[model samples]
Target chain A: MNWILLATIAALLIPIYEAWQDENIWQTMLAFSSIASKTSIMILIVSVLRDDWTLGVVGVIILSVGNAALMLLAHIIRRTNEL
Target chain B: MSEQLYIIPIVLLLPLTGCMLVLQVNPYHALVIRGIFGAIAALVYVLFGAADVALTEALVGTMLSITLYAVAVRSSLSLRVGAIEDQLKAHTARELLSVLRATFSKHHLRLEIVPYTNLLAMQAALRAKEIHCSYVLSEPGGSPSPPGGGSRYDIQTRVSRLYEIMQAEVPPTKAYLRYIDLANPDKSTEVPIPEAMEGKS
Candidate 1:
């Protein structure tokens, strides 16, 4: 559990690093989705460890819904940019 | 200290580092950085056993706010205009530009004008979406106008959903515009000829 916490914490930096280095809007959105998924996974782990079903439900919602919103926004932006 | 005790440090340190890093990024990269900050904060809430706070951070902070920011950024609209070189050289064109600036500002849009040597090039730019619109003059030469004869401003914008917004927001330029054709620039080389003005004075 401790090692999982440490690894998730470490993984959090990857999106920040990618965002800083890449200037493309789509790439930035990709980084955001990555961050969202990783964070949801961390929440899920914490919920399982604590046996908190409510927290587990929240994590599931984020895991399922968050990336969809990001992808939709990215698509809209990209289409607008092409215009 | 117990190994479990170090979880507090991980929670505190990771989010703090993310916050500091976020502040260091350029504003253009802010969307992604903001999402990263929210994620880190949510993780911190989970570490503290505050599942409710974590959920709020994950949903509102991470997801909803970022989408709102994206929509806001999208609304910072800009329009590109390709002008015939002869048209831009006219005195009325400058006044038209100032009017455009005043009018477009009402809708929070910025207008950029790029001059092209010929109508064909201007039309091409508009068709390619390289420019949102093009400006053509009713008369090209420095001809003295007869009595009751005036210059017609033929501004053609790429037909889009936003065209209606632009039309509704048009400032009072010298001439009123009426759409005469739905001509596609790609297939048409037929240009609108300026009405030959008879010297009436």
Candidate 2:
């Protein structure tokens, strides 16, 4: 279980590095979406590890809300590009 | 008991992402990194046994605040320049617009076009502070200044900082740049055109 969480943290670094180095706004957004879902997944894993129901529920909410935020951001950015 | 090993690294990730967020130079890119920071913060909060705090951070900090800030940055970081509608279709107008875009982008400001039906309407918008600048096409040797009447273009800006910026970057030959002092009531805002100006937005 510890190894699983450690590996997930390692995977999370990939997107962070990508977000930092990429100059394109869309690419940074892509990395942000990746990091958002990955972090929420980590929260869920922690919940399962500790058997905490509240943490589990929060994880689910964050997971879904993150994607919705991404959708809103993408639309605004697209309008900017068109204009 | 041995689980303490990964906790240090997980907590370390917080500062790592935080640093990246601070290092971003562009406002739009910074906002995206801010979302990334909020996500990591929520995860760290949950790790520290603060479930409710984590939930608030993810919802308000990540989702709600990011959306709001993105909207604010997109709108505020732009310079609104008004132009007469029909004159904008001219080939010279296109060249002038490209030059304006190139100059403004260097300062991280986006140029937005606000079209008005006529010269009077555009001047009114500028005096009302609805636009930061206005582009006028004057007639050859300077008169009437009908839409696309001449190659000569006039760039008028009420803002001093914008005037200074353009005064340095935009050459006088390309377009005649003027700084209008709106505070002085005596200064004429009127162009010599005789109601011949027409444009579309």
User: What fraction of the reference interface contacts is present in each model, in order?
Assistant: 0.50, 0.80
Clashing pairs in 1: none
Tens-place lDDT per residue, model 1, B96-191, is 777777876556466777889987877667666687667666554433233355564666665554445546665323533333234643542222
Restricted to chain B, the TM-score per model reads: 0.47, 0.83
Alpha carbon lDDT of residue A75, candidate 2? 91
lDDT of 2 by residue, B11-96 (tens): 99889988888877888888889999999999989999999999899889988898899888888999999999988799989998
Give candidate 2's error at residue A77 in angstroms: 1.3
Best by DockQ: 2
Candidate 2: tens digits of C-alpha lDDT, residues A8-62:
9899999999999957999999899989989989999999999999999999999
Worst ten in a row by lDDT for model 1 chain B: B185-194
Runs off by more than 4 Å, candidate 2: B143-150, B185-201
Candidate 1 lDDT at B201 equals 17
* Chain A TM per prediction: 0.89, 0.95
